[model samples]
Target: MIEPVELIGLAAGFLTAFSTVPQSIRIIRVRQAAAVSAGTYFMLLGSYILWLVYGIIQGAISIIFWNVIGIILGAAVLIMKLFIWKD
Candidate 1:
């Protein structure tokens, strides 16, 4: 019953949402974030937050679901970059 475009959106959202997993895992495994850019993650987190808000306003479940995941994963990276890892 799902439309083709909706399926595409879901697929794209899934890809972008989980894209940060590898970076998070790497940071956790190595326990270092010298190569990570705080500013970039900051901006990315902000963008994800905005998208999440928009999704809420628009009642777009796909956007809401994927952006939540993106926010969580992105925040993990930012947190590690700012707090956990020294550099």
Candidate 2:
């Protein structure tokens, strides 16, 4: 069973991981990424990768899981920005 504090951490992770989803969806829906900053997404992706590596080293499941999700979401935005969406 997850303790209350752990559950709070997991919830926070989940929210943060999925926070990019709305942006991704909007980009896809509009088929435009004129306002999206590829540089920002690149930085976010790098941070997520570093966090993932640290989580792996620390054997932190929540960190690993959430960072993986964050990576995927961030990648989706980047892909749309770089390849699919156009101004």
Candidate 3:
């Protein structure tokens, strides 16, 4: 049985991970990565990495999985912003 804290973490992770979908879609569809901040994404990626490591250490699969996905998405956005931005 999952504890309440685990369940809460799972829900929060799911929400945060899924919430990026729309922004990602918008960036892709419009091909406008100008509004994306590389610094912010990098910071987010770093934070996620830490969270993932912590999750692994604590045996919290929810945090580990969500942070893994978040890292990927965050990297993708940063890369896209770097390559696609005209300025």
- What's the number of clashes in each of the models? 1, 0, 0
All candidates: TM-score: 0.91, 0.91, 0.81
Q: Who is ahead in lDDT, 1 or 3?
A: 1
Q: How does candidate 2 fare on TM-score? A: 0.91
Ranking by TM-score: 1, 2, 3
Task: Estimate candidate 1's alpha-carbon lDDT, on a 0 to 1 scale.
Answer: 0.90
The per-residue C-alpha lDDT of model 1 at residue 35 equals 89
Error of 3 at 6 (Å): 3.5
Sort by lDDT, best first: what order?
2, 1, 3
Supply candidate 3's per-residue lDDT for 13: 94
Candidate 1 error regions (>4 Å): none
Clashing pairs in 2: none
Off by over 4 Å in 3: 1-5
CA lDDT scores, all candidates in order: 0.90, 0.92, 0.80
Instruction: Give the least accurate 10-residue stretch of model 1, judged by summed lDDT.
Output: 78-87
